[model samples]
Structures are given as structure tokens and as C-alpha cells.
Target: MKYKTFQTIILISSIFLSIGGCVTSKPSAENNTNYTISPPVSNNKMVHVNGTKIVDGNGNHIKLKAVLLEGWLMWNGTLWGAGLTSETKITQRLEKMAGKEQTELFRTAIYDHFITEKDIEMIAEIGLNTVRVPFNHTILEDKNPLEDYSARGWKYLDNLMTWCERYNIYVVLDFHSLPGGQGAFVSDPEFINVWHSEEHQQRTVDIWKAIANRYKDRQIVAGYDLINEPDAPTGKNLVDLQKRIISEIRKVDKLHMIILEGGNFSSDFSMYDSPLDGNQVYGFHTYNFFTDETDVKNLEKLSELAKKQNVPLWNGEFGAHKLSWIEDQLELYENPKFPINGWTFWPWKRVSENSNRYRNLAKIIPGDDWKEVAKGISDLFGPSNKITPEFTKKAMDSFIEAVKAENIVYDTEVKDLLKKY
Candidate 1:
């Protein structure tokens, strides 16, 4: 879609909003989700949210600030897994992410997350106001396939909305695993050799229509992510077909937000002369995994697009390939042009509470999942010199030795992790 700026101000004034604050420690839920620390605790970055200017889901205006909960394993597993499911586990994680303010979400895979009303209760207590539900085509229909909402999945979706409404968390129905997997899912047999086939395009539109009709009410459902990320193809026809999908989504869900992605995987955000509609918003996926550009360039692009679109530009996904960069990015070196409502890196931990080995098992929590702890986050995670056996034994000995002295206090948290490895 194509988006441009607007300059119409009848009146303006400064407003004092309560910025959120929280402890740097990983949160625990096995006992309670209460926090004991105070702010100016650092967040992932200097999250500067643009204000006064109005924005909206459809055509209306609203304020935006969000964090992506991408793939939180425990949140889904604890609620809808095959064996054990716990509300306490999921709620604890969400509550921690909510910090002290209302948080939005961009859930990567909401697959099999259909569970009981009790699950919804836990989510509400955590302070979430929105959820993006990604539906695999299989769940919508079983055919080789046209766009059709799966029989069993649609029923569960309705139930999900019912529970969401009760808890007040809005929903974004994302067509996550599209026929031709977007990027990571690109290995799927469906899209490998046929991204531009006429069959693929028709199927997508038909499926969207069915979905829009099923949930026409704009109140509970926030928006549709259109088709995840559109990439380049060896065949020109297929590439054109990919862009057409956005037009199709707009046709049906005109009132809701249409999330248009950039070229060849969501990573590259360059203008190809072919731009998104001005009415819709541009979606980008940024990561430290593979990049040659400087942070300055990245920030400049974000700002330029914001000025051009006059709409929100969201970082659908981003995380540090290594744990070391976490603290570095948190310093907020670059100035972003647009308002980034929220973002979700890839997946959350499968076991949110188990890592409480007295240590955090929830991925977002410190040491919960090594991958997440290391991503775009530092300080909280220890150095690489940590993965040793003797180091652990010595640290344990020192801790035991320190406890013997009643007059002293020893903080050996980092030491324990070295030994655990």
C-alpha cells in the first residue's frame, strides 16, 4: 500500500503520559507475578514513541507503542500443549512483559493455542491489550487449496475472540503460514516452485474473503497481517502476484490495518518504485543475524518512511544474533522517524517456568532461554567464558564459603550459570 504524510493541526498541547518502568531481573510466576524494583530501569532501547498525531486501525487515529512476543513457547505450550498446560506459567510471562503499562503483541505462531477460558484469565492479569493470531492454511481448510478457513480452526477462533473480548485484548488475525511459506517457512513444498502461479493468488483472495465475512465485526479483531512477508522470485509473474495479495486484502478488510511487507524476505526495506498504498502501513522485519549496513542507515530508513507514510512503521521482528549486543542497542543510538507501535522477535520459550531451577526458564526472562537472553540484550547475560565445568565448581565453593561468614553478602548469580553449563 502507499502511505504519505498529512499536516492538519487545529490545535496542539503537550501531554504528560506515565511512561512505564520495571526491574531488570527476570520475573517469576510460580509464586507471584509481583515486581520489587523501581525505574529508570533500562528497556531494550530508548523507546521514544511519537505523540499528539492520531493513527488508527482503519481510518481513525490512535497512539501506538508495542513489543513483539513473537514465538513464546511456554505461553502457548503451557496453555495448549499435548501434556502439561499451566495458566500460572503463561500469565507470569505476560505479566512481566506488560511491565507497568498496556502492551500490544505480534505473536508469530498462535498454532494450537486454543484452550480454556482459564487461559484468557491469566493473559488479562498480565496487561495485554492486543493479540495477532497467525493461522496456517491447513487450519483454515484441507484442500490442495483455495483460501478457506478450516472447519475446526474457525470454531476455535470464535472461542478465542470470545475469551479475548472478556479480557479486553484485541486480536490481529495473521495468515502466518501462507501457502508458499513467507521466509523461514519458505522450505514448505507449497510455495517452492509456484509463488506466482494463478492458483496461489486466487486461493489467497478467496481465503481472505471467507475470513473477513466470518469476523466482520471490527471491534474485537484488530487487523489482518495480509500475507506475512512477500519476497522476490525467479519468475516475474510470481512477484507481481505477490503484490496483488495486498490489494486483495484491502478489498475485503478495508476498515482494518493492512500490514505491507518489503522485498525478498522482510529484511530489505528499499523502495522499488512500487510502494504500498498511502492508506496502509509498511511492515519491516529487522535482525542482527545478517547485516552489512550501519545502525545509522537503518534508523534513517525508518524515519524517511515515517515521514512519507504518515502512518506507523512496525518492526515485526528483530533480535540480537548474539547476547552481547543487547545492552548496546538499548542505548538507542539512532533516531527513528516513524512511530513503532510494537514488535516480536521469533519465538518464546517452550517451558516458561521450569527453568526456575530458581533461574528463569521463560525465554524473555534473564537466562530463561539462551537464545533470547543473548538476542539484542546484554549485561543481563554473562560472557561466553561462562560455559565451563571447573568454573562452576569453584563458584559453588566460593558461594558456600561466603555464606559461612554472617557479616558479609555475596552475589554469585553469574557464577552459578557458568557451573550449570
Candidate 2:
């Protein structure tokens, strides 16, 4: 499917949903529809790890230079200028302020505008060959998760894969948040309950099975990232859960590579003495405020681990730091001793009143009312209840408008930096 075709489908779906009621309205059994996914495009070949390197179907070694699509399917509050907060909390707050219908509309607006074909084109133009798509479990499943998947969620993935396929970019499906929260970080703010609940663990595994089944034959899908930056009680527990998920996914998907992140925000890997699976990639993330010394040590450790296990390594998430820090990390990744198979930058875009902290490829300019609105939502200056619904609507609408691809300001310096490697 082409980009214009996707737009037409979205327009028609929106119209149909509007006639029936709100797009996010709870569906009745009689009116329920499952989204039809287009057949996977075979422009790219399936990639697998071949002794510490990722080789494609034709046995060509490939290094995945990628960017993450954050704040799109998973609505992190920080991305929308609302401080560090979870998607669930943000949605609940939006509903409290704007009624369910209006809140759903706001979500629809963000989903439609956040990352379009134009954005994918820009990524390809920047010379990145892959995309890291992070999503919350709710994006694919409804309240009754195991029974059926959401049509809306399927549409989002289908559209993304179609766009990536068109641009020859591989997609890494990252399950950023699971049934219960996987970590205490803002990225997993539903609550850190998944680590303790067996039901949540099973749900998490089942979610991967479903995703793997859906994209089993899709060559453009580079891998199925089991969980993102998990924070388990013990490294053994983490590896056990990961191994189980891998076992289940292998039942449905044998071709796609399985990517695993260690516990403690993917910074620890002491539990594994050897690779658990043949085609697995061990992914690690780096986020430091002041120094690259720690990063240097960690990369060297991961290099030794990769060499010992004879598996590929990926810097699945990094960036959101000073430009100089990004350059330093890039150099570290490309060092022949470390031998990193690939690396994906943390975020492709972000909205910031202050860009002095961490630079992103695209800068989202939240409107004049944003600072107050952001404070209100995050309860910095005051509780969200203190803000009028009218004010909330105005500020949020403007922010949504600002998130459009056409409205974004790309940083050429960042683009040039990415193009260099």
C-alpha cells in the first residue's frame, strides 16, 4: 500500500467511525471489525545474526543505523511537553479534563500526525536503514487482552510497516511497555507490577506470540524486541521470562531475530554465561548525564560478552544527550574492538522548551500556552484540575497541530552527523 492509499483508508475509517459515534467508542460484538493487514512487501530480505554480525537473506552483512519512533504509539507525557509521565496517566488526565470523546479525538490527532510517510522519507534521506518502533501493550489489545486485538492498533502497525517497506527501512518491533509495567521509569509508568504478576508475565509472552504470528513472514521486520529496559528483581528471573517468551515466539516465528535487553535498564548482563538462542541479539541502552567514561567501560564489557557468547550486540536505545556526547558514543560504537552490530538513537523527535539538555533530530515547538499546560498536567505549578477545560483544549490542540511533520523543525547538524556513519 502506498502513502496516499493509507491516507484515503484513514479518512474513510474516520468518516465511518464518526457516523457510528466516536472512533474510540467501545465496540459492540455485531459491529466489531478486525483490521485487514496488507500482505508483507518483500523488498528487503530477512536478517539474522551470523557470528556477531547481522547478515541478510543473501548473506550480506548489515549494520542497522536506526532512529526510534517514540511518543507516537506510546504517548509519553514528556514528548508532549507534559513532563515525565506514563501514557495511561496522561490519557486518564485528558479524559478527566476533556470527556472521553474529546480525549479520544486528541489521541487520534496525535497518532495521525506524529510520524507519517514524509517522516519516514526524511529518515531514509538521512541514511538510516532501520526504525525502532516502541509501543505499549494497549496499542494492540483492548481491555480483554487475550481474546482479541484492537483494529486501531493493527492499522497503526500496518501503516508503519507499509511506509518503512516503501522506503527500504527495516523495522524492529519494540514492546516498550508490557501487561504490567516492566520498569519504574517514565517509559513504563503503568506501574511496576509486571515483574511480580504471573498473569502479567503470561500476557506479555502471549503478546509477543501474537505479534510474531502476524509478522512472521515479513522480511522488513528485522526483529521482535521482547521487552524494553526491564527491571526484574533478579537477573535469573529476567532471563527465565525472556527464555520463555523466546520459546513461545519461536513456535510461531522462527525467521525473525529475537532481541533481549538485560535488567537494570539494560545496563547489566552478568546472568548470561552464554547465548540462550542461536539467532538472538543482546540489546543494551546508554543514558548518561555528564560522562562517557562509564559508557566506554560498558561497551567494552558488552563487546567481551558478545565475543564470549558469539552473538550479535545492538545499542538498541541511546542519545537524548549533548551533541558532543552523541559524537563520542558514535565513535565508541564504531571502535573495532567493541564490534557493535548496530545502534539506534533514542528519539527521532521531541518537544522541548529547553534544547540545551538533549538534542533530537526534529524539534517540536509547543505553542505559547504549552509551558503552563505542561506544568498543569504534570502537577508542577498546580494540579490539572485547576486548569480550565477550555484552556486545556486550546493548549492541547495547539500542541497537536505543532506535532505535524510539516510543522517540525529538523536539525540539519544532527542529520549531517547521522549521515556521516
Candidate 3:
């Protein structure tokens, strides 16, 4: 629970590396022949929930082997080497270090290069059928309600959805960051507790409702993941908020599956009494620290809950461990008695400069006094206080190149394990 600074850095890195590494290898000709790559099924159909299984419109079962796209729309300080702790801080510091125009340029460069068409092709090639795209609420909504928030965020998401459609990969849109921070980390920047504030809770519901309405008919979107690893200090409050969000979503889109995560970082489900809807999936998250027996026992509890509610159980997030640890957890997930519907690995990529490949995919900008910045001398996230426009341009170039290059390291063992089931 208490992660040292270095360990936290390593864990964030490993989370991305472990998942991203799985898709890095180029599929051999024989391997490609093993799996038939087909055009996406007609967009007229939607994925729905059956008893303990996710099935397509035709009733064919779908086991969603997925990977999470982290640190793209959402910023994690440790993962990106910014040391600012939140996306808001990261953006603010970027603006301070470089003017608004230059900041936009930097962001565009990183976002454009971070994930490309090739990545989606590789994911589909590996036999995984779904991806969970984690995004910050701010991307689609500005602080000022009157301003148009959908334009900027939609551009990127639209691109991703198009790519997913091309590859027949279902996407689970995850609202990782809420209006007010839901948890205590960079991913959930609103630290004031979203559940306690009526305004924040409404904002959360409104944003989800808007998203549901927009993508309701798009089959490429697997579902609306209501939230990601929400840490509601009060369990009842979390349940109430989720109920409200689900109610609002159903008002518009009843076709797509709705994913509801458990409280306490998605590891506890004691508050849940029944499935919110027939097409709902209960979400849970696990880490690599648990013992194998403990993992099996906990998953069995989830299975029991799924059976009791007559819905499916999804490991919405898990990873950041050795290949052996990942194999053990995957085995537990594949166990028939537990009957887990599916799981999404924590991250798809991180910058791996050391032996421990669990760090951020984006490397730190070199020639900068990042150590002092990490220690909190100043909030600037670039090279230095005396940073010139020329230096900024060069640094941004090198940083972008490093990110694109570092994001492609492969872990053959993890890939092999995932390809099995």
C-alpha cells in the first residue's frame, strides 16, 4: 500500500510495459494464418450481456481479451516523467515552460506519435478483440460549462474508433478522470471526493450521458465504462452515484453494455446488491501483489456475485508484474469454475530504459534538471528554467522520438501466454 517514490515509478512503468510489450512482436506468417483476420462485423450490431458472458447481437459469446490505453489522453506523472502528479498540473507546467501555441504543438506531437494505426493492427493480430481507452474528463469537457468541450477530445477518439472499426476491435471508453478527482493519483486528479459533491456527481452523470448519446449506435464502441478504479471513501455514496449515472445512460442508450466498477479502487463489491440492468457488467481490478490462492479465492467471490446477480464479471484492469505472475493470474482468470467474462490489462506501453520495464512509455526530456523538479523545486516540466525556443523545439523532437521508439519493446513470454486464451 505504501509505495516508495522509486517503486511507484517502477510500478507505473511496468504497468505499461507489461501490456504494451505483449503486442510488440511482429506476427509470423504461420501465426497470422492461425487466426483469421476479418473485417468488422456490420456496425448495426451491439455487444450485450448474457448470463456470465458477453455476447454479440447474434448470441455468439465474446471473451474480451483487452489492453488499456493509458497515458495518452490521461497523463500520469510517473509514467510520462513529468513529476507534476496530475494532468492539470502537467498541462499548466507545459504552458508555463512553453507558450500556449508551443504547448499545443508539443501536445499534438506526442498525441499523434504515441499510438498509431500500426498499434491497433498489432493488437488485432495478437487475437485480442477489445481495447479499453482510458481518458480524462477534461479532454471532452472544459471547466466552463458554456464552452464547447466535445470538439477537441472527439477528434482523437473519432480517429481511434475508426481504427478499431477497421480492425474489428471493440473499444470500451473509460472515464478515468472525473470532474473532481475521484482518487488520490494523477489519473484521478479531483481529490475533493466526487461522491460528496452534488455538482461533481451531476457533472459526472451529464458527461457520461452525453457520451452515451453520441456513440449509442456505434457498434465499434463496446460499452460505456462508467468509471475507472473509482475510490469512493463511502461505499453507499459510490453506489448511489453509479445508480444515477446508469439511470442517465439508460435514458439514451439501452443497447450498449454498461460497465459498473466496484468501490475501493474497484477491488470491493460488498455494496452491490443486484445487476443495475440486464446488459450490465460488474467491473473489478486486481494487481500483481496477491498470492495465487488469494487471487483464485477473490475471483471465486466475484464469480459468485456474478451468478447471484445474473450478470457478467469483468476484470476491468490488471497487470504490472513479472511474466510468471501475469501467467498465474491469467490462469486463474481462465479457470472454468470462476467463469470470469474477460479482463483488460492495465497499460499498452511505457518507456523502458532499465531492466525493470514497468515505467512510463514516455521518457524524461534529457539535459533538464528533472531530479530537482521531481523533488519539487519548480513545477516546470520541460528541460530548464533558461529554456530557449530552439532548445524547446529540439527537446520536444527528441522526446517524441524517444516515446515512439521506446513504446515498441516486446515481451514474447507475456504475448505467448495471452495468445493461449
Highest lDDT against the true fold, candidate: 2
Local accuracy of candidate 1 as per-residue lDDT tens digits, 1-421: 0000100110010000001101121221122123121111122121111231324333344322222333321122221121121222232232243321211121212333323454445434434455555555555666413223366567667887898788776666666555544333222345331243345456676677788777765466655667565543322332344345545554554454456566544645564233444334556665453332335566567656666646566555443233234223322322233455544333212223332221221232212232231221122232244323343333323322221213122123322221222
lDDT of each: 0.40, 0.75, 0.68
The residue ranges of model 3 lying beyond 4 angstroms of the native Cα positions read: 1-44, 82-84, 143-149, 187-191, 289-294, 353-392, 405-407
Q: Candidate 1: TM-score? A: 0.53
Quote the positional error of residue 233 for candidate 1 in Å. Answer: 1.9
Predicted model with the maximum TM-score: 2
* lDDT order of candidates, top first: 2, 3, 1
Taking all chains together, each candidate's TM-score versus the true structure is 0.53, 0.85, 0.80
Who is ahead in TM-score, 1 or 3? 3
Task: Give the per-residue lDDT of model 3 (tens digit) for 124-185.
Answer: 88788999998888878764333344686787888999999999999999988887656555
Ranking by TM-score: 2, 3, 1
Candidate 2 backbone overlaps, count: 0
Quote the lDDT for 421 in model 3.
69
On the 0 to 100 scale, the lDDT of residue 232 in model 1 is 37
Q: Of the candidates numbered 2 and 3, which has the greater TM-score value?
A: 2
